[model samples]
Target: MTSPLSEPADDVIRAALKAHGGLDRWRNVAYVSADVAFDGVAWNTKTREHPLSHARVTVETGEQRTVLTPFLGADRRSSYSPGLAAVVLADGRVERARSQPRAAFVNDTGETAWDELKLAYFTGFAFWNYLNLPFLVARPGFAVEEVAPVKTSTGTWQRVSYSFPREIATHNRVQAMYFDEEGILQRLDYNSEIFGGQPTAHMLSGYETVDGIQFPTRREIVPRDQDGTPAAGPVLIGMTFTDIEVVNARA
Candidate 1:
């Protein structure tokens, strides 16, 4: 049967899915939990130059609930769902957090409780979406189109442009993903509307298989120059995930 996506787009998508384990196996996954180390300019921007921190992240894929616990200092946890978000403090106080997720990204005005909480929600939702790629692209409502191939230092990469529904958690509604010849995702390009339309080039590497799925353990995001080249500067956001556990609710 012909796919709903363009022929070239569908071919690349199928190749990517097969390389990362089939769609059927991914659909069977219920939840994923991981220990992650996060560091970068983005974190520093939020925490007044605080360095790398360990975090425990959990995502209920079926229900789209994401929770993140940062182990740098306070004993607190942040959780986000479709329209609601909350931060649980050490004393078991639940603070209602509000975020305009789709708003354009802006420079840090000043650190406030609500701003910190909103960052938590944004990071949690962003990582959850990042951890589940290609698979997430296969879901309905995403429009995929094949773009002209681009030659990088590595080789020619097949480019796929995506238009996501507003409800999907992502930096922007329109983004581009590049895949290697083996169908592994190499780079992602998007404008962070929230950060005032900052264009970024996010590179994914260090692939590891967990529960029949291939996931990139290391991610590095940097600002992109006008020509789409990575700008020379500290990484905007860098992260590595370990101790990943994908739980199958259907099992």
Candidate 2:
């Protein structure tokens, strides 16, 4: 059966599968781990621990990459509180920033990635049937639309843009993604003030094979406008993965 999104030019399904690690490998995957870095600095490390039910995440930053997960029933729907008094949501109901001691959270109503990260898991928004992908996959209202291909340093690829959700999280904005014809995620573009360093645009390319799974090892971030166009003297940042753990079926 052809999906509603199926068309001659819209061969994104076939392209997506082959672009990723392939069907057999994608369906069989359990968990994944990658050493993450930014600006030549080992800023952090990340792990996507997936169970048959839901996925968990452990992100290490600062000096060491720490292993942290939602406190179970505590994190439901659109709120996350991990250890101590860290609270994150798409509605700005809780206060948890170390810097913002008394800044009452202003409810701005839009797409937010900070709240999305609290739930763990990354990408897999459109491809993976929206199951066992990441916390962001279940965000309240994300508008997905297929757009024209945009030229990049790599090559021509199809683009899928996600609009702002009705609710707002700790992070104000969200980054959009670009997928290739083979459905392999090629580039991700977004404007993140919290993570993108400076109001910047980010591009992830150079997909390589590691442990039989196709992963984007090289990522570049540069300052850009709200539309993702690089500014003058665009700074190029890079990241590479050294070790990886692809799901533990026994555990």
Candidate 3:
């Protein structure tokens, strides 16, 4: 089938796919599992202060289910699915839950029960989208166009602006990705509507090959200004994934 991405953008995407492992290799995978350590300023919005307890996440790719353990507080698991979100405490009790997206989450008046779980929903889906990158852009309902090159201290980067279909769950419907000469994704730019439409810069580094796929072990997301330059201050979110596992659906 013909790709939606422009010819130049398609070339870059193909190089990225080959660098990561190959579209066919990623397409065959049914699920991927990894233990992740989550921390950053983004979490502060939920707690109203810096967090002390650790957060561990497990994502199911095909099913689109994200399970967050030790979220907000210890021994708590927040499971976010398509239509519903649930939080289970240590004692096996469903502490706080919600059935669907709410209107209140759109406006940032203050945090509420619905807001908390909605954040979980956003995180779950955002991570899933971030983990699956160049290949995901090739999927149906996604459009990609090459943008002007970005010159940095290190080198000039090839850029591409892409958008997700409304049906696809992501932090934002449209975002831009920057790749280095070798086709490794170096940065991602987007305005996260979930976070008040704040411009964000997500950096990918510490690449590790897991099961023949190149995965970024370290990720840092920070606020960016209107000019797409990094904003001053600490990062919004910093995470690292370890203990990676991938299983093919066909297998």
Candidate 4:
């Protein structure tokens, strides 16, 4: 095993980690809990919106785990990990479970409405990967490539394309993430395989520091064209995180 510093994309990754907070501070964190309100064209297109209107979400920092409370009802919660997704009682008894949840989305185009279990799987993997960017690139099993710098009104942004290993369930492999010269994340581009390979771009902003970590408070998504430029029309998914707290990692 080689040190991450020796990797090709180390410079950019390290810059991002340092600008957000050192890896040391991130390692001590167990999870991030926040109250988020989700809305946008994505949800509005669904048969019904996810029960996530003003819900609380907790995402594990070191692993691919997430829990969303008040999921469909006030007492039920959705639990997710790389291998499984389930809706469970407050006591954690599984009311439903889907092992190998990613497989369930095989050939799935998220354009159509989804059932309860499908929604659980989608919510789980989506946030689990979304909240763990830039830093997660340094973790094992991800192949990172520093791409060409892009210039925009915001500033000159550095882009890195990340390929996820099989062990992780994510929106798509080879997602390109953009960071400002200051190393803060600004946008992301990828084709959501589950959504039938529709190209999409995530425009991120509204940063707030918690426990010495810089976290994004707002995420806006839009369609992307073949050239990697974001669409100017309707926003796909608009997510805002509030009252975010970084919990200490367990001993």
lDDT ranking, high to low: 4, 1, 3, 2
lDDT of 4 at 88: 93
Which has the greatest TM-score? 4
In model 1, the Cα lDDT at residue 83 comes to 66
lDDT of 4 by residue, 137-169 (tens): 767778888889999997899998889888778
Could you tell me which residue pairs clash in candidate 2? 15-181, 15-182, 15-183, 16-182, 16-183, 31-247, 60-65, 60-66, 90-168
TM-score for all predictions? 0.86, 0.50, 0.84, 0.92
Mark the regions of model 2 whose C-alpha exceeds 4 Å error after superposition: 1-14, 22-24, 40-142, 163-174, 181-183, 193-199, 232-238
Global fold similarity of model 3 (TM-score): 0.84
Cα lDDT of model 3 by residue, 103-170, tens digit: 43666643422355776676677766877676678666778888899998889899988999776677
- Root-mean-square deviation (CA) per prediction: 4.2, 11.1, 3.9, 2.7
The stretch of ten residues in a row with the least summed lDDT in candidate 3 is: 1-10
Range of the 10 consecutive residues with the lowest summed lDDT in candidate 2: 124-133
* Deviation of model 2 at 118, angstroms: 12
Off by over 4 Å in 4: 1-9, 47-51
| Residues 83-177, model 1: lDDT tens digits | 66667777777765655542423443433222555666576678767877777777667888999988988888999998887666777888998
lDDT of 4 at 187: 95
> What lDDT does model 3 reach?
0.74
Q: Ranking under TM-score, best-scoring first?
A: 4, 1, 3, 2
